[model samples]
Target chain A: MRRAGVLALVVTTLAVAAALDTPAASAAASRLAWLVPVALGAVTLGTRPGALVALLAVSFRAPDILAGVERDGLTAVTFDAAGDAVVLLAAAVMTGSLAAAARLQRRRYEALGAVQRVLAIEAPLERTLRRVIACLDWRLGCAALTLTLRDGDAVATASAGCSALAASGNRDPVTREVLRSGRIVYLADAGGQPRPRRVLGAPLTAAGVTIGALVAERTGELSPPERETLVMLAAHVGLGLENARLAAMNRRAASELDTKIAAATHRLAEADRAKSAIVALASHELRTPLAALLGFSELLATLDFARDEVRRLAGIVRRETARLARLVDDVLDLSRIERGLPVPLGPRRVAVAAALEAAVEIFAGVDADGTGRRFAIECEAALPRVVADPDALDRIVKNLIANAVKYSPPGSPVGITARAVEGAVEVTVADAGRGIAPEARARVFEPYYRAPDVVRGVPGTGLGLAVVKALVEAHGGTITLDSAPGAGTRVTFRLPIAREASSAAPVD
Target chain B: MLAALGALAGAAAVLGGHGLLPPRAAALIAVAAMNAAFIATALAWAGAPGAGAVAAGLVLAASGAAAGHPAGAIAYLALPAWLASLARGGRLVGLGLGARPPAPALLAGAALGVGLIAHLALTVSRTRGYGFALGPPSVVLSSLAYDVGVNVPCAECFLRGALFNRAQRRWSLHGAMALAVALGLARYLADPLLPHASEVLAGAVFYVALLGMGNCWLFWRWGSLVPGTLSGILLFEGYRLLVVS
Candidate 1:
């Protein structure tokens, strides 16, 4: 609006000045006098207006000045006319310069606005690239853009206006120059069969490393200034491209890692199945030998009364062999349970208190001399009968009680408790001794895994807890440990009470 | 005494700002000294050296206002120094005496100086329209001189020192430089096409928005926004001032 007003005022003032300076009014330059007032009016309006008025005034005086020179034969009037021309030219240049400056400023603000939009919203990488490309294209008057980036040796990737352009690979020279010199490259034209008329290439370098080249293509030619501008634009474009690429690479890596972890998990599950099978086979194979060893040891014990000294030696051998047979039996049982092999179990409705007493009776004769451990059973009188495999149940209870007695400190009491809990029998065997560490607690139930805090040289097989855990679970029960280092250890197992006698029996 | 001290500080600030002294250290010291003087002599009236402080303040405010364009206003502020020589009864005459040869010469000289500065700024602004536009011939030359002779190298030092900071994290000098270059380029490409006061103002607002948005993305994905943001600010402003000023 200001420009328009100024231009209007200039044109009007010049028109008025030309009228006053017309040849007819020259003789009456003093008489015509209205031109001065008009000129003053134009100045008040604005410079453009004043200049316009002056221009008109001079144009009007031009003919008179020319006529006077012709008639009077003097160059003074012609010189005066030329002076007016010079003033008008000066005014025109000033207006033109201001207009150009205004245009430049407007461009700058528009660019800022575009950048603002880029920053204001969350956009995908592709969208950002497009926006950046559009911004550069709009400002530089370039038709197409190509950003070629080096990965290791060759161009890692190239973003181009047309995929076909990328296919042609005209950007190699620019890329090579940037890669070699690590400097911006400007080309007036790509001198090839299918060359772009004007090309501006700048190295997209970060940390003094020339990572890529940004090339802007134009149809005609670029001025030196325009070329320089393109190089700068390319540099910025390179940055945007690098950001996008890095984001993409990171995303790709994350996805790849996720897939790898999934594959690893599947392989681990397969390995677990294999281990279970191995344990089952080993246990089944050892059962026969274990039974034979037990029979021989019992037979030898009976024939041990020939002589006092010989008898005592035979008793020692018999005890050691019996212990070895028991160890083998425990391993076979643990392996069978782990592999889900059917065991000969008879289910019957039995009183929970009777079962606890029976397990205690079986362990009463065990050597607890060194430990001085005593066993006690505390069963609620009102505890309901639980239907289970009596032999398996007895073995589970006996194993827990024996372990407690064997491992507890001397003079400590091994407590056995049985109670009715939510339609189930809850039994716990607790021992006062060195406790299991938090790290080893989970592994203690696994075959051959013993708590490190247990004395290194102990008598029992480490499969005790493994067999206990399996037998408990087979009866639709759960076993867990409540123990910490130095606080002693308590192992608890819960078995569901059978609703009917038939429910306790396993189906074929 | 405080008032006198403040006057000295004020003088130092002017010298620092005007490049008569090294800008970085001088700027820091001058700022501290002037602020202290302002507080210490807070109750002092405008008399004796106090007047000089007031004058210095006015100059500073004017120069700061014209920071991006360091011509018109800065030169106008300096013009009075030459006029002081022609003082008559503590006031200089204009029209008759002002139009005298000597006075015109002084005014012409001042105008030329201002015009030259404005021209230089415009040229720089044109050349440096994008991140650190310091890559341009003009900037590279000036930076070289500064690094070799003045040895201040504030920007370079900042970049190098900042690498050691854990809080500054994302340790890519290349990425920083790239961001700088992008913003600078954006400004340059933007300015000529949208050349207008309203447009320039709008552009500035938009540029800031871009920086903020880009930084936010960096922060969200990488958990660090400072590097991207710092580079953007430095490059954008540097480009605007140097190439497009």
Candidate 2:
């Protein structure tokens, strides 16, 4: 581009030199030669270069045009030479002006496209604001820029190539005025002043309401067209900021959805594990009793025997049949518990010692396998009467004693202790039996859960302890188990003490 | 808007030149029509539909009266002296009649008004042939009554009471104040009394804008129109004492 300007300069200078050297008649024709360089420079190089060439042409042509004027007061040749000079200058100016306007229009469209590209994507607010500043600095040639937005009651600021605080903190009075007045404020220092800059501040408005402000500083005069561009850009910037905030909100909602899905997957994995353990324990415990009842009844029906032999076989069949019924009942209760149904209860005040003795007697007789169980019962004197259904409390105690008797060796004493502690009646059943491992302690209350090493040898369903825990909790009480493998297990439960004996109403 | 003002001013000049009316009466009618133009615009902007007819009647009355009977020419002056009666509990009280403005606000307004008058009186321009208008005490007092009673209340009604009240809801305090100042300058532009010289016109703009901005602040700070009206009365009274024509 500079090379074109230099070529224009040489041609324009040569044209003037020719006009000065030629005769008066021919010099007028030569003066028009400068038009060629002006037209070519404007088309190829740009506006300023073409206009500069015009000034140089007119200056070189000046002397010849004036020489005739001093010799002969206003001759026609001088008038003709001057008219040609005017036409040359006018041509240069007109071409340059048109070129300058076209260049400005293209720059404006490019700047708008740059701003729209940053706003089209959903991005963070800080990223969006930084791009806005970068867009103005790169496209508008702003030496410094500051964008301030109102975040609730506070102002949030972004700066490019300038101190954010200086512009936002009233270092530029025009910025404050623009924010307060919602108008464009322009300030240009006089030309003679040192380090002069033009500062422009415009309101950033959304929906005809001002939400923030933008300030731009550059080393030039503020053109009316640039001011208009700022006004339109400010509106786009406000909407861009709103879009960024929405993106942040969407990200948070997505994160919450991911967390919920993870929780549901974990619950499903736990349920699958529980189902596998139930299948293994239930098949063995149910089949053992069924095989015993089937063999004894078949033997009695098929063979003729003495009366005593027949009676003994009949006793074996009745014992196995009863065990089968118990197992079926336990399976039904476990199913109901797994479905999250609350245990039904009927409540009345019952003497704590009396309830324990009755539960003990029920289990003290010969077991279903014709095995006798040794038991011990201990109660603190003056133990408070507890508000409970007599039948539910009896079943709770019976389940715990039964779990201990099943796990204990033959004739091992199962101890039952009852006392009033912390405004409640506490009962504990302990057995000197093969104890539960520490790993299985946490899930002992879970229905149908059994130790992998212990369930194959045990001759009962793994539902006794879980049923006892639920029945205790339904009476507004708590139950805890303490055990270690190869040691012994102790299960304790507490129910709130009754205010008056037998005064509590029945369960709903 | 400028074309509308130019048309009204040009109408009087053409009428006077064609001897359709005596020159002084025509000039008086033209000034009245210019003043009425501002009033008509304000009323119409406020959604009152009858402003144009009222403005026309005012000009017609000014046209019929002779120049020597200045009061007769502006016979509307008779009602201005009592217009203060409507100001105390005005019908427009529904629009931001805030707590009674503190006494200090009135004092500050008077000080500003006095200060503005001091600047105008001390800086009389010789090149523009501008100075204080002189007349008998009766004429001066009558004009002062019009300034205090009619003009102050009317300007306060539209600029601070109507426009500022609505604009502040959508703009910042300074934004609303700036609009009042800009509208005040436009009102001067439509007036025939505004001088044609560029420097005098600039000075008039500076003072009018300053007065308008200050009055907007006064009303916005207290949410009431009384202090601004008081300041306006003082400023225009001062303006009357220092007029060029």
Candidate 3:
């Protein structure tokens, strides 16, 4: 629209100058006024067109110059005409140069605005790519435009204004050169069937990686502004592509966050439910033993009872109190471990054989009924002493022996074995009893998790194995349990040998 | 105890001179009384020392204004009170001096409309032969400077910042709004230009009261004195532009 206004202005100015050139209307002052339109034309239309208008104005003044020659002389008329020509040419040159500079600045501003608009588009990458291609095609007057994104061993192409120019393979020579050199490449003519007369390729790089290429084709050599604009457009396209990728990643992260929140909420609810169950069960378990102790104590205080009855009730109270103490201790131990407090470890060199014998002796003393529960101990002679916390080791061995005896049937044998192997001490506890179910074996070491089948028959807090596992791991050891329903269970653990033992041994 | 003294001073200013007191004196009395009410309410409800200091500041400003002090002198009189209040180390929200996320577009549109209406009203008064003209450049400049630097801040701080916030907490919203209206109308009681019981007097009172209520609502909504002060300055400048002669 602006270009047409300038054209109309140029035409009107020329016609007015021509009308004023008539012999009846001729005046020297009016002739001088003709310079105004010539200057205007130069500023609006630039050097060449402005010079043409100036020439036309000079021609229109020829008749007056002839008349001047008649009135004065040829020499004077020649001087006047030469001076007029010089003034007109000067106006054209100066105004034309200024106009060209202004045009270049305006084009740069427009290019920046277009790039901003392209970059501001918040859409999927494919949609943004198509919009950018369309913008470039319209702004640069490209016959066709294509953007090729390189994925691993694959290329995805988006085209505007031409489908035949779509990339047929993972590579195009122009695009390849631009991507490899990280520079703009131009082809005078695309040398292929249905080729464009000119093509420009620029690498779309982001974060030091050439993610894609922008290719534009037209039917003539691109001007410098056009080439520069294409380069600017390619840079904006790279940024827009990066933004799209980041947006996609953000969306994925949000979805993942939602999933994690849901899972955490579920786990919290499950924990709350488990806590309620533990409270109910623990209260019932405590109340039952308390009722017996209270009832028997009340009878002893208020009524005369036989000596045998008194002794039996006293024994029952003693057992119940011991059970309550054990339960409290287990609860406190697990709480301390979960709170991440440091567990005390008194490290010293201790013989594994002596630890085993001591645990077995304690077990024998505790088996007051003496239903023939037996332990088979096997230890390698001359085994190097392991550096350990003695009390912790004693707890580990005693807990294993107690578990074995508690789970096995009366008269069944429990086995304890220890040996030094490959810079470590390995221990195994085997029991012939109703083994843990395959599904329950994995969870036996979980705090407060009792086997459903044995919980009703056995008197235990389900913390024995959990405590065992924790102590073993705290001492830089690994523990594993192998068991199946109706099959005997085997528990094995290994602890690294004391550093001094390994260092002191001579090389064989 | 300070609030009681401020209230007594306000009562003396309003009731002592009967109909002979100047309009400015009556306005100062109303400002002092409102400040006293606010301080009493805040002390009873929250025991906030900031409220006491703000009340003291308003009383000082009233005293200065009653003595025909310049706007800058009055502001200086109020500065110590503001400092004392700030040193109490409590949230300023209870005093309506904090920002809330009110709709910006709505506030801006309302401010523009209020400015235009004020200008139009002054122009109409000029056309009605009330003698309005653009004054000398000095008069215009001084009026703008005083409105921005003193009058808008003082009026907004007393009415919306302290009184409205305390009233809202002490009474129901409607009751608080009623208190604001009553205090606003009291400013016109001693004006000699509009004689007592005249229709013009009643109209002025109603208009001023409405302005006060609207600004209080703005303060409550935005939880800040800023919008009210900004609107007050705009209206003051517009009125000055139209009728400063």
Candidate 4:
């Protein structure tokens, strides 16, 4: 309201001075006239609302001058009043131009803010284009806004806010000129029809390429600066649209990764099922062959072959056949033990001294072979009578002795000792060989596991210790091993005394 | 009706032992002879489905009678149904070995006894008077002293408790009945007519010694007894300690 009052007074003073024909006749008003416009113009120099008020006041004064001439004869007016009218018209033009510039500058700032908000809300290219077209209609006072983007060679309409421009396929001199020159083009007022008053066009350039054209229509005449604001807004919309397109592509790539992971998981489950079936079938097939080997070996041993050579051959056959039986039994026993089945147990009254002697005799024959590992047996005659399964005891002794002989180098003495302690018969088996490393000792009793440094083609199934530990524990005995790398191994087990059967006091 | 109540109480005890019974049902059975009231209603409500369906009508009557209020009846019945449904959907079916029908009767009896005792234990920590014991010496009465100065345990010293089952898998009932008889007879045979009689019973001792020895043998033969063999041994030992010690 203050801007309007200042603008009105300036226009009146300028017009009165301009109506005078001679500069001398209007000189006083003209000098004052300069001050009035300068102050009003300065108040709204960079602001649209203030500049608009100045333009309106200047335009209003022009009408009054024209009305005065029509109402009264031109002869009645002074020469200076006519001269002042000419100067007032000139001043109005300057004020109107300033107001239009400020209005255009303000519109561009508002359009930039609106475009940023749209990009923030919607990230897809097609959606951003749709919003750009809608904002041009609402904010720029355009009757129609059409966007035609180049997708490969063909230029096609991507989105449109106005129905009429979209129906016409958007091909016009203005659009073609902007696309070809990659610059802004404006058509003003369309010869005062008001219906097709103005059209402004600008090329949407992104990454140094002319990608598309943005065209807006105005129902009223547009000044030079109004046309410039439309063109700048068009470029900002193009940049926002490009960012959205790249984001969509990234989302598509992430979806493909999820699909591949699901496929791989399905394949792994199928492989696991196939492996379980193979183990079941193979174990079932081995059973029959093992039974045949044991059957024939028993028959051959009973034959009583005449010559000593024949009998020796029979003994070798029995030994070899027994090895085959052991392999199959180990496989079945490992599976059963892992499945949590209990191992059978037997108890007998055994002389502790005799058991040690028997174990030494068994290992003595094996040590005599080319391996040349020596055997030593130490027994305390006063060792208590142990109630244990003799058959299980023999397996424990044999496994430990055989393991020692197999692992140690020639000339390393394998030691065995027995004693009575804590109302129990305790036996110890020690072997001087490449001892088990600490890291590997924890896994030595796990069926089928072998250390990394062990000979890759070794014969044993790695089930010996597991079986020995199980059998000993079933007879109420505890076994422990002590070993270190290169120091050799010592294993000991203790069997409880037969309390019910023995009434005699401890020999110790 | 009383016989039925007794059977149900036995069933509750078994379930409590295995931890199979729903908490609400266990609590109800633990309240004095609360199951006796339910058995009476079940009998009165049987063959009278039009009165409201046998199970529903009996539950309604029993809950009201046992709890002595309508609101309490709603609580007792509704809580069990809700809790049972929650358990049945997952943990009860997945983890509990005693949920199967064959074990329910045994589990039920044990559950009732243990739950009641446990509830009482929580409230009265020092009293253990209601607990039962079984085993030959603890359950039987006898007089015998060893002239050889060897420790001769009294029959009643070993008695923890007795297990009675009418349905024990088809023909196995005969063997179970015979075992119970032999165990009972051994209790009476502990008293000697003369000093030499103690020495003469050595063969009998050897024969009966097979009982303890055979149990240990089976433990070795079978890797794992589903539901665990240790639980039974602990239950027996606990009873022995309670009475004899």
- Candidate 3 to truth, TM: 0.42
Candidate 4 deviant stretches above 4 angstroms: A1-96, A123-125, A152-196, A265-508, B1-245
> Which CAPRI tier for candidate 3?
incorrect
Per lDDT, the best of the predicted structures is: 2
lDDT for A384 in candidate 4 is: 62
DockQ of each: 0.01, 0.01, 0.00, 0.00
Q: List ranges where model 3 is wrong by over 4 Å.
A: A1-197, A202-212, A218-236, A284-319, A347-391, A401-413, A432-442, A450-462, A485-488, A495-508, B1-245
TM-score attained by chain A of model 1: 0.46
Question: Interface-residue RMSD per candidate?
Answer: 26.6, 19.8, 34.4, 52.9
Per-residue CA lDDT of candidate 1, range A1-508, in tens?
6566566555655555566544465434522343453344343443344454444444344444444554566576656555655655465446544554455556555655565455344465556655666665566566567666676665654344542233456535665676688787665444321222455668876556777777776654354545555555555555655666676678889999999999999867855764565465446535544565566566666665456765656555555565556556676786677677965557777676887887676556544365445778888878776767887887788788878777767778889998889989899999987778899988888776655556344544467888888888877789999888778889999988766555644421
TM-score of 2: 0.51
* Regions of model 1 farther than 4 Å from truth: A1-326, A336-347, A368-372, A455-461, A501-508, B1-245
lDDT of 3 at A145: 80
Model 3 clashing-pair count: 0
Docking class of 2: incorrect
Error of 4 at A216 (Å): 1.8
lDDT (Cα, tens digit) per residue for candidate 4, span A357-381: 7877756764546665667888886
Residue A468 in model 3: shift from native, Å? 1.3
Across residues A1-508, which tens digit of lDDT does each residue of candidate 2 receive? 6686677667766765566555563663566567777766665566656765665555455445544554565788878877877777688778877776676678777877887787776665667778778887777777678887776677777778753325445565666787789888866531211123556788887667677888887653355677677767777787666656666777889989889889989877876776676676678778887998888888887889899999888877776786677667667766777798876667887887988887787677555445566789999999878888786787788788888887878778899999999989999999999898888888878776777767667755568777877778889999999888878899999999887645545432
**For candidate 3, lDDT tens digit of each residue in B1-245?**
65565565566565656765675566555545544454444433334565555545565554455346444333433533452355345444444443343678347536743844453454345333233467776566656654554455555555666666556544444566678667656644543323464433533553455467667666545555666766766766665665423
Clash pairs, candidate 2, are A347-A507
In TM-score terms, candidate 1 sits at: 0.35
Q: How far out, in Å, is residue A346 in model 1?
A: 4.9
